[model samples]
Target chain A: MLLIPCPYCGLRDESEFVYGGPARALPDMDAQTPEAQHSLYRPINPRGPLRELWYHSGGCECWITLTRNTITHEFEDDLS
Target chain B: MGYSALSLMGHAFRGNTQWPTLIAAPDMRTIYDIVIIGGGGHGLATAHYLAKIYGLTNIAVCEAGWIGGGNTARNTTIVRSDYLLNGSFALKHFALKLWEDLTQDLDFNIMYEPRGYIDLAHSDGELEQFELRANAMRLRGADAQILDRSALKARIPLLSLDMDKRFPVSGALFQPAGGVVRHDAVAWGFARKASQAGIHIFQNCPVTGFDISDGVLQGVQTAKGHITCKQALISVAGESSAVAGLAGINLPLNSINVQACVTEPVKPALDAVVNYNVGLSYLSQTAKGEFVLGGATDGYASFARRGSFERIEDVLARAVQMFPFLSRLRLMRHWSGTADITADGNAIVGQTPVSGLMINSGWGYAGFKATPAVGHQLAELLATGILPDLIAPFALDRFALGAEQDDAGIGPYPWLH
Candidate 1:
């Protein structure tokens, strides 16, 4: 089990939160381009350290961003 | 020596010492007509058909580990073709037809049992949805029967059909043709047949990079030595994105760990594969009487071939709910496999941006059921340089064309599927 440390809720179990996928800049909300489709469909997934979004759904309900290793499932100390 | 009653009796009388090896270790060459990147069942099957059907003898299958040590040996081994979509049902049914004659075709026992599959519904709404899906399946030339509560009880005698329970027995969708197969035998069978056809099988040989220039055919760089080939097929299931990345090709794939567990041996209790659909958990008893249970993927993207306890607990809870007597049994083993999921739940086959590179991946946790079909179609693609019509719908350009085969109706959520 992953022990995700939320910025507001401190540390919580993985079941207490929901995964928000790899953290990347969202395309313009109103832009209707092929890039929007690419952004929505082709996520920046890698087998190394990646910044991702997580929702503390079972706790503070705050969406948090953290850099975690995708293979190791370990979180870095710095949270943005 | 061919496997038969005479061969078995001869071996038994001779103290089992005269049996020859299934496949011999052959010398690897510096160049081949084609090199399959992963030596899993799909890759080996592709080689087998390439040599058998297409009459291409120069082929090499490079494995990062031992053959059949990956998801080919980890899945619960359920094969079914009752799909709501036309493409999925057709492709899967074609594979099922091949499976009927697979043991004879390969001259290896695969233990393909047609024990039927039942998907239980817990409510009226769910039953209605199953009925609609059943109608769609029947329209596509597959067998799907809707069984009410009483019929389900007669089929599965051990099931708890009490109405006051948490998940009451509403009804089920039964497909008599769906069943299980011995997973490991598939890879070994394909490898033996392909090796017999003079195809090279390399173990512990990993492809580190690709040799591509001017956007045309070249070769692959491996750990042992660089091997040149006329074409390359990327069929690595979990590492589809990672391996394709080496060729500077980006695939819309996310790898997640899907887990399955088996209980200690017990007397034969379950006769058919049962899916408690409300909980998304399914189980079937092996010929040895051990119950194999599996559920949804671990709702996150990770390459680690292990899963969290919470998902296992949820699966066990539902398993016990359906079969109330399962509380006494102990779990024997629990393991996970990295599933290469796509934005749409369907697989991606056919050409890539590179000229000589092709891919047959994004299978997620359901690749085992489509092995023969993928192998046949990919072999044709490699030989003729044309995607078969059956698999053309699964092309990578479907995403840009807004023709994604979203069988689950889920939108762009890799983990959810």
Candidate 2:
């Protein structure tokens, strides 16, 4: 079974988290410029450290965001 | 495209469209540009769209059995357009509208009653979820209303409202567009309309071999004769994998057997369909007063399509739990149909790896209600040689593209859900 560390609900079994793959970065609501902020919000299909979003549907009712190594599943931080 | 195997052969035993039988028919002069396997609701619906909508008359629906003999005839017959997602608008709403206007369109009484459907809630969490669903549907321009315990109790007085009662029916999400129809009539109208459009509806002809040349469909070989075709549509839900395999094509379908049973005739008790996510059971009273019920799948994915007595009992038990009065009603008959279970529990439509092959299977069990929209989009794809945006994500390629619609908020229904 795949084990995942959900940012919101903490580290849990994969079944507890709905696999959301890579997290899509959203621009800040109060970004100074639409074009300048859009650069930081561009979708990245990175082959390295990736921010993944997961829904802790089976355990906690929250959408978790985490930055993790895609190949290794080693997450840097958990943000529930 | 109306394919009613029941109405085509007058409800006779189904036949297979084996490769050998299709070669021998005396009427070999007609060579269609596109040939569809299975003359069920999907096939017929496709035929109608191809001819009337797309003006593509070079189509043949080869059926080994009569039309609608497959799942089209065996479905629970509950039609609903209330969905929890935005992607389902085309099929859900389009099909519901077509179902509402079906009788008038076909000049045939499909017995379509706009009695609507209700999703019962037994807990607070369930109520919140139902509200979300109702709200989502409303936002999508669908006619949906969330009923509180009092409102639901007033609408369905016979429903169990007492807290201590077994599986208390507390609140319900009502969808006025949800209702029942004469399944056979749907098949009949499509078949008649498709036939009039010059679509060759070949009965007792099985397509066992697909003649693919240079990775493109050359034609199909059957038992009776061979019909050269430029393209082919495999809409056979239950037998989708086998049909795809015959063409040397791979479809991501895990076939399973889903069962539905009917109870002895009684006065109409439940005005609308009531179901829950936990049990994956749906029960509705037919126009003839028979309780048509669907239960969770009994077995995992397999080739067998047999219904066990245990599942029938399970279905009856759930029905009884919902309305205890159903316990007295005798089980009249039960039937099992094949479900081409997909990973996401949605259909796989549009182009496949094969050059000239289009797939419209993997419906799980939502085929009956989404027939019209599926047909419309599929025909457009076939005629224009492009996947319509409506069912594009339903493609098998979506998994590889990493854009799969993995989350369909409908909490467990039957099959893969």
Can you give the TM-score per candidate against the true fold?
A: 0.97, 0.76
> Quick one: best TM-score, which candidate?
1
Highest DockQ model number? 1
Q: Score the docking of each candidate (DockQ).
A: 0.71, 0.02
Error of 2 at B293 (Å): 1.0
CA-based DockQ, model 2: 0.02
Model 1, B183-226: lDDT tens digits are: 99999999999988899888898999999989876999988888
Each candidate's lDDT (Cα)? Answer: 0.89, 0.72
Per-residue C-alpha lDDT of model 2 across residues B19-117, encoded as one tens digit per residue = 122112336444678988888888888888899878887778888777768888888888897677666655678788777776666555788887879
Runs in model 1 with CA error above 4 Å? Answer: A78-80
Q: Over 4 Å off in model 2, which ranges?
A: A1-80, B1-26, B407-416
- Predicted candidate 1 versus true structure: per-residue lDDT over A1-80, tens digit per residue: 88898888777899999988877678998878787887877757788787888888899989988888878888885445
Instruction: Please estimate how well model 1 matches the true structure, expressed as its whole-model Cα lDDT.
Output: 0.89
Docking class of 1: medium
| Clash count list over all predictions | 0, 38
- Number of the predicted model whose lDDT against the real structure is largest: 1
